[model samples]
Target: MLVLTRRRGQAICIGDNIRIVVTRIEDGQVRLGIESSDNVTILREELLETVKQANQSALSSAPEAFNHWLNQQPKAVDDAGNTKDKA
Candidate 1:
């Protein structure tokens, strides 16, 4: 991983479009403001892991049965750019 030091209001770029700016530092928590495309999605690590577990549970509940049920539902995009069924 690339490591760099940045203060509040300082920013970093990812690829061509995404920009992450350090907005504030308080109690060791850093607040960030993201300037990027609307299509871009981001999620915290723990939340991402939770979503993965949920998806695995959903998929494992049943194989053919779950697949059939999932196929019938409309897909929704989650905060992490993942598609999830509303069911």
Candidate 2:
């Protein structure tokens, strides 16, 4: 990681189309303003991690959920694809 020190109102440029400006610094917090092309996707690290964890959890439980659903379904057909009578 490249680290640089910049006071408020200073800016940093990345590549040709990205710019990050130090907009505010107060109460030990530094705020940045980023300018980028419309096609670029910017996301916070914590939110991205949360989404990944949720997706992993859902995937882990999918097979159990599917089995529960399959058990609840009506046995309307046999292995040969013939309809089975409930009676």
Candidate 3:
């Protein structure tokens, strides 16, 4: 990774479409303001992980496969003559 120092209101450029600006520095935390094109996506770690997991799951399985897996699970019965899963 490239390392550089930027004070408040200063910015670092990444090519022509992206920029990172130093917005705040306090409590040992450095805040950055990102400037990017509309097509670019920037997300927090957990959000990124969710997106990746969703994409991977979609790619690795089909609707039919999921339905088959669901069918294999044990069914439930209730005293009211309804499936236990039914409300």
Most accurate candidate by TM-score: 1
**Candidate 1, clashing residue pairs?**
none
> How many collisions per candidate?
0, 0, 0
**Per-model lDDT:** 0.90, 0.90, 0.87
Rank order by TM-score, top first? Answer: 1, 3, 2
Residues 24-60 of candidate 2: C-alpha lDDT, one tens digit per residue = 9999999999999998877789999998999999999
List TM-score per model, in order.
Answer: 0.67, 0.61, 0.63
**Model 3: per-residue lDDT, tens digit, 1-87?**
888988998999999999989999999999999999999998989999999999989878888797888877776887786675422
TM-score, prediction 1: 0.67
Please say which candidate is ahead in lDDT: 1 or 3.
1
In model 1, how large is the Cα lDDT of residue 55? 93
Model 1, 1-87: lDDT tens digits are: 999899999999998889999999999899998888878878888999999999998778768886777798888999999988776
Report residue 69 deviation for candidate 2 (angstroms). Answer: 11
Q: Choose 1 or 2, whichever is better by TM-score.
A: 1
